[model samples]
Target: MPDLEPHRRELHVHCYRMLASYEEAEDAVQETFLKAWRGWDKFDGDNLFRAWLYRIATNVCLDMIRRTSRQVVTMNSFAEVPWLQPFPDRMLPSDEEPDAVVVNRETIELAFIATMQLLPARQRAAFIARDVLDWSAKETASLLDISVAAANSALQRARATMQEKLPERRSEWTSAELSDEERDLLARFIDAHERCDAAAAIAAAAQDIRVTMPPAPMCFNGLDQLAPLLERAFGPDRDGDWKLVPTVANRMPCSASYLRRPGDTVFRVFKMDVLRVADGKIAEITTFGPSATLKAFDLPQTL
Candidate 1:
């Protein structure tokens, strides 16, 4: 029996991109494996195993997708997708070369994932199959059970939609790994929070920064608007102290913040901030979860 474990992570990531929700993607992968197991006798064993598994996974996602609305997501803000979740960079398939790293980074960025919501499910599948996965038109057509011309057409539309929806800063999406500049900025952000210096934290952000805590209707845009919020967050005599551990998510910098109350012995996981850094500034911050279960990220239990 062929072990499906090796393809599990990438399949989860693929499904995450397809479904735009971490939890659902996880289930999709498990289901994918279960289906693969039941159908193992039919597998030719001569064809590419990864491709065969992806075909099944993609079909599963598309079937699930057909049950949902294909509304062209003209989201006024990212807050609309409460289901949107972070993808940890550490979990990405390891690649040593800089160029290869960047290629992986582009497809998994928050912007890319969010914008992809706009396309019809079939078109999204076709586009991702051909462009992101580097599948040939014939391969994509076969995967989606469509003609090659239709697959190419879908791919073109997806590319156009992505180009229109993505921010201008898309060009700066390259960083084989965190550069010195990104680390310094992350350090300042961590220091500001840990030291309870609201001003310093606010200063590290871009003027047109955006903060979104998903599943919350609130999103603060611009420093002038968001400054007061950070002020209270780092306010003096705040109930407890914050400790930040650097982590990476969605191929960008992030921090997992733990809170220790005045008399508490252990620091508990409180929330996470997934950062979108560009031009040496924190352009976007998406924070959610007092996530205690972080074995997925290999994070410490308490500090």
Candidate 2:
């Protein structure tokens, strides 16, 4: 009702940070928009439109967290069926101003999101609103419907918990600050995957890189380990003729890799592999998702 398009996209991003699942974020944003429309007549344009949207989105996410528990996929926590889903890279709306103008991988990585899941709902909101979004304590307090002092307390607790859970690579976490060379490195990584060249792919990765596949509990660390892993995945014996569709997730450059099967004479979409780079080399890789959301990334299901 009030110039919704600009605020809508940002609100979607905000909801995503609150609720790591992309589908849930979409639902929350829809609910926020509907509520905004219904309450439009009573609105006073005193505060920023984005701020008002954040308030709605925050409340929506809070309701969701109150109802559902955080998703965990560790070895001790494996279940009869996988419970979490990866966000499709293609569905994330592009920015006219480039990645610099939007959120970064440091704040939105799957690792960070999983770490956030450990915090209480209000503490999670307070930390993200204050630290990640750069909102002031007073502003975050107003949005969360709590006192500024309480917000500050929640944020501090959240930060302390996250510091222990996440890796200590704060310098490389800022995705907005990636250099031209770093971007080019990602481009080359994509090119290598599309060409199905394992050597080139290995060359692009760090010597001791860590590749983690969520919801699967498979992890390969170090170049020696990763080389064999890549060979098994992309080699001629298994899932040959690989094609990587360019996309993004967690505010980081990503690709949904598809495999061309000779027996079926068609390409089958498979994994969503999201990358994290540091110092112009692939540092971490997290892969997941099924065919349902894979199509949303504009990837070829059967090429």
Candidate 3:
């Protein structure tokens, strides 16, 4: 039998894009590998091994999606899909990998992942395969076991939906790396958290900034709604002293926060905030708990 380990990372990323959860993607990759090993005799020597693995991985994701009741009824905010999670940059394929799927800023960002949840399972797979992965219509159809015409139709619908739901300026965002403006804004954000300065944080955010904490039904829009939360976070009787470390997730600027409650000597991992910046200010902040994600970022549990 041939080695299957080489394809693991890219397969995991493909599953992540389809399912929008890190843990679920990991499971899907494992299931794919198991199925591939069991059915290796079915594989033709003439066909590409990587594509075969992807076919298995994609189907695994589709099965997982069907079994779960994680459908999104409306395409509004990231909070609406509580299952949404950030993909750590450390696990992404390095720029040097030849066959690695290009993890561009537009495709892997939080907004794109959350919006993709609005698509049906098959359409999401089609979009990722045909458009994101640059697969041919015939190739995608073969992967999904559908006719070429049907695959094209699915890609069309998926593209239309993505364009409608994604931000208008998405087309204009060309840089794959973080810009200086974004780094500056992130610095201000981290400094504000460490200093407990709400004003500085607010200044770094857009006037209509939005905040959402997933797995919790909390969504706050605009600075007016955001102020009270910041006030409480930095208040005299707040949880404790805060420490923030800058990191990158989903090709966007992020901060991993640590908190030391009253009498707690060491700061402990709290949550991660993935920022979506617009016009030099933070336009959206999607926050996730640190327990399931910190290790992916290679962050310490306590400081």
Candidate 4:
């Protein structure tokens, strides 16, 4: 048997991009491998093995999407995607794999993932294969088990939707790593959160910053809305004191927060806030529960 383990990480990234849920993507990759193993004899020796695996993975994601009740009409905000989850930066393929699809910061960012949920399953698959993976039209068609024309059409529609829905700034789609300014801002964010200084934290954020806690369907837009929430969170009556650990997710800066509640001696895992920085200020924050795989972030469950 071929060494399937070598392809696991990249395949996991692919499935992650397709499903936008870390747990579901992990499941899809496992299902893909199982299906590939069972159907190994059917795979042609002349064909690309990686592509074959991807086809299986894409189909698995499509089926998973079909089974879900979630629907995206117009994704005005990440709040609309209650199922959206963050991908750990450490789990991504290393830079040594120059050809890895996860190298593209734009494709793996939380905003991109949320916007992609707006696409239909096959269109999502087609877009990822053709655009992010740089597969040829015919190859994408073969992977999706569709005709070349249909694949091309799906790709076009997907492109149009992405173009219409994605952020308007050109720099937002670049492959660059987080800049020094972003790192500085992240440090300030962590400091403010840890100190429970609502004023300091709000000062670091943009005036029109947006905060959303996914799987909750709530959005706090602008400083006016976010201010009171921060005050309440940092208030004496708050459930706990916060301790934030600096981390990266989806190629963006993040803070893995732990809470030492009243009467509790140890701080336990709480939630993660992934920041989207713009113009040297924190523009958006997507908060996900600690349900994420913390080992990937090298984070201890308690402190």
Pick the TM-score winner: 3
State how far residue 170 of model 1 sits from its true place (Å). 2.4
The C-alpha stretches of model 3 lying farther than 4 A from their native spots are: none
lDDT of each: 0.80, 0.71, 0.89, 0.87
Q: Residue pairs in steric clash, candidate 4? A: none
Residue-wise lDDT of candidate 4 within 19-136, one digit each (tens)?
8888889888889889999999999989988888888999999899999945598887898988888988888888677345556788888878888889999999999998889999
**Better model by lDDT, 2 or 4?**
4
> Distance (Å) between predicted and true CA of 196, model 3?
0.3
User: Against the true structure, whose lDDT is highest?
Assistant: 3
On the 0 to 100 scale, the lDDT of residue 278 in model 2 is 70
Q: What is the lDDT of residue 273 in candidate 1?
A: 89
Candidate 1 weakest ten by summed lDDT? 95-104
Candidate numbers, best lDDT first, in rank order: 3, 4, 1, 2
Candidate 2 Cα deviation (angstroms), residue 214: 2.6
Which of the two candidates, 1 or 4, achieves a greater lDDT against the reference?
A: 4
What lDDT score is found at residue 146 in candidate 1?
Answer: 87
What would you estimate as the lDDT of candidate 4? 0.87
Report the lDDT tens digits of candidate 1 across residue range 136-224: 99999989888999989999988898888878866566654877877899999999999998878878999999988876767889998
Could you tally the backbone clashes for each prediction?
0, 0, 0, 0
Model 2, 59-98: lDDT tens digits are: 9899998888663333211121133455554444456622
